[model samples]
Target: MEIIRINERPQQVTPRGVKARAVLDVPYINIMNLTLAPGDEVPSHTTPVDVLFHIIEGEGSVTVGPETAKVSAGEIVVSPAGIPHALAANAGTHFSVLVIKTPNPKNMAKSG
Candidate 1:
């Protein structure tokens, strides 16, 4: 068995410019903790694997495909594979979220 303490991970800037910490990365799945400061945004992007976003702190706007909604802590959002999705922090609020990607994209491509 393995254990991970989310708060203990070092947050770093992701390639997309958001602060993120990779919590888990394995063949089957990947998990990350992301923080978006006020005014920060993650541009829409499509993934090869399905994704779930669990809001951990603050409020933000989440866009999945053509639908967009204002989300807050304790809420969750799903973005299916190949669909564009994005997240943005409210004008003066910080947003923290747990990002989970299933069937690791790399592994999925290998199995195809």
Candidate 2:
């Protein structure tokens, strides 16, 4: 059995300045934890693959394509392939969520 300890992973700062940690990376899927401080946001951007956001803690807003919603822990949001998506932490609190990208975009590049 393989074990992945998310907290043990080194934190990486994305281009948008959000704190993140790569939790899982494989040929089929990629998963990462994103932590955003109050007022922090991951700007809207388009990706070539489907994305799933699983809320881990705190509250935040998620925008997938044209719709946006305030999501809290235990909620899951889906962003279809080739669409724009973004995330923002609510004021006065921190937000953490798991970002899962299916089919692993890196592998998609290698095969496409």
Q: Rate the local accuracy (lDDT) of all candidates.
A: 0.94, 0.95
TM-score per candidate, in order?
0.93, 0.97
lDDT string, candidate 1, 1-112, tens digits: 8789988999899999999998998999999999999989999999998999999999999999999999999999999999999999998999999999998887888889
lDDT of 2 by residue, 1-112 (tens): 9999889999989888999999999999999999999989999998888999999999999999899999999999999999999999999989999999998999999998
Scanning candidate 1 in windows of ten residues, the lowest lDDT window is 103-112
In model 2, the Cα lDDT at residue 27 comes to 94
State candidate 1's TM-score.
0.93
lDDT assessment of candidate 2: 0.95
True-structure RMSD, every candidate: 1.3, 0.7
